[model samples]
Target: MKLAVVGGGSTYTPELIDGFARLRDTLPVEELVLVDPAAERLELVGGLARRIFARQGHGGRIVTTSDLDAGIEGADAVLLQLRVGGQAAREQDETWPLECGCVGQETTGAGGLAKALRTVPVVLDIAERVRRTNPGAWIIDFTNPVGIVTRALLEAGHKAVGLCNVAIGFQRKFAGMLGVAPVDVHLDHVGLNHLTWETGVRLGGPEDENVLPKLLAEHGDAVAADLRMPRDVLDRLGVVPSYYLRYYYAHDEVVREQRTKPSRAAEVAEMERELLKMYGDPELAEKPALLGKRGGAYYSEAAVDLAASLLGAGGSPYQVVNTYNKGTLPFLPDDAVIEVQAAVGKSGPHPLPVPSVDPLYAGLMANVTAYEDLALQAALHGGRDRVFRALLAHPLVGQYAYADALTDQLIAHNREHLAWA
Candidate 1:
């Protein structure tokens, strides 16, 4: 099967390439296309991709191009990982929200809404192009603000599924702590993208015994340390919240911490420079160790598994993915996209049934879902009012004064990306 990566020039591409090379048995790709408008970065990443494939003894041919239509034409699956405004825009996204005394994250709060607005239109255009070229192709989105982007794709009637490394990352972490293979550790992962919780850690299968209590009992401190949360919080909730929850559970503290540190985008920008320099080394046949620090850990594995299942190849039957709720959570609207464990196949993901959610988590999920709905509206039909309303609705930026100031800052920093601005 042929596959296309729209943002193949990204520093994250090597990790993905490494996965495609290592997991060829899972997703046997014949022609792999790297599509990016940044010709220089694309060339560097493309060269490394080919070397990784060859070093791994994979027989697939790798191609690179700037033409979106030509690159995705006739591909069985297309993965979206593009950043509409690059790291420069991301720096703004991660910094300006701090001016409002709020979290400056790329995937949530005011910054996330900015990313959603900038990303949705570009992704929609790409999806339309893909639809025109290969109507049967599955769009696997790995872009940030995935819930909003995937919702845009699905609403526009594209064949799509959103992938995040959070669930896989947790599975791997839990497996290492449990002395089991990652596949054997099934997470009862539920909630919206980036705002999820591991309600249960099952073994064998979804219906298998839940070992979450055992894990907490034994490794609560370690888990809490990893999440940067208090151990007692986990003990009280009896569930592991994704790291993103820190922005909510400790909003003021996180904002203070963020204010003290350089924006993640700035750090990533410097890292990308070093990574690109490393990618240029003809002798570098494998993904560099420094790339590990660049994040998106285990993304390759998740992408491979998702693509394989979507292509009707052998892969894990159940995996965590962002797709329509379809009543998996009674609290969420059926059309709202949610991240959860699902049985994935050629048709797409069908989220597994979840038990009644504790109001503690369900309330937050419902609140964010409503914010996301408004965020999507702002993204689709851009206006100062829509943007302000979305920011006002966010749990993190609920105050009108903060929302008003942040809305103007978001548009100001992202005027070039926002067509309406």
Candidate 2:
């Protein structure tokens, strides 16, 4: 099968290459194309990719190019990992929100809104081109604000599925803690992307016994520590919340911490510099250990599994993915994209049935779904009012003053990206 990576020049690409090399039997890619506008970075990353593949004795052909159309032409699958304005824009997204006493995160609040607006247009154009070049190709989006981006693709009538590493990361960690293989542990992971909860941890299959209570009783402290939340909070909630939920559960405290530290974007920028330097070395045949600290842990494995299943190759039958709700949650609209466990195959992901959601988490999910709805509107048809309305609706920025201030800052920082600005 031919597979194309749209942002293969990124420092994160080698980790993906490592997975592709290791899991060749899962998604036997015949021709792999790396598409990026940055010629220098593409060459550096592409060279390392080939070396990694050769080191693992995979026979796939590796190609690199700046032309998106040419790179994806006739490919069976196109993966979208592009960043519209690069890390410079991300820096702005991570810092400006703190000015409003809000969390400066890349996938939530004002920062996420800015990213959605900048990213949606570019991704749509790419999807349109992919449709024209290869109508049968599947689009796997690993882009930030995945819920919004995936919704855009599906609404535009393209075959797409959203992938994230959160569920896989959780599964691996839980398995190591439980002294079991990763495949034997199944998570009842549900909610929207980045805003999800592990309602249950089952063994063997979706209908198997739930071991979540045992895990909490024995390892709640460690889980809480990893999430930077108090152990008592987990006890009170009776469920494990994703680290992203910390932004909501402790908004003011998170804002204070964010204000004191350098933005994550800045730290990642420095890490990318070092990672690119490491990628240039001819002797480096494996992904560097430093890449682990660069984040997106287990992203490659998640991508490979999702891509393989979508292309009718072998992959895990049930996995967590972002797809249409279709009444899985009575509270959410049918078209709302949610992250949940699903039976994945060539047709697409069919989200497994979920138990009734507690009012607390369901309320928040409904609220954010509304915010996402407005965010998509602002992205598709740009205007100052729509942006302001979306910000006002967000649970993080519900106040009129903060929404007004954030809207101005978002527009000012992103004027070059927003054609209507």
- Which candidate tops lDDT? 2
Could you tell me the C-alpha RMSD of candidate 1 in Å?
Answer: 0.6
Each model's TM-score?
A: 0.99, 0.99
Model 1 local distance difference test score? 0.95
Clashing pairs in 1: none
lDDT tens digits by residue: candidate 1, 127-183: 999999999999999998999999999999999999999999999999999999988
Evaluate model 1: give its TM-score.
0.99
| Per-candidate clash tally | 0, 0
Please report how far candidate 1 places residue 83 from its true position, in Å.
Answer: 0.4
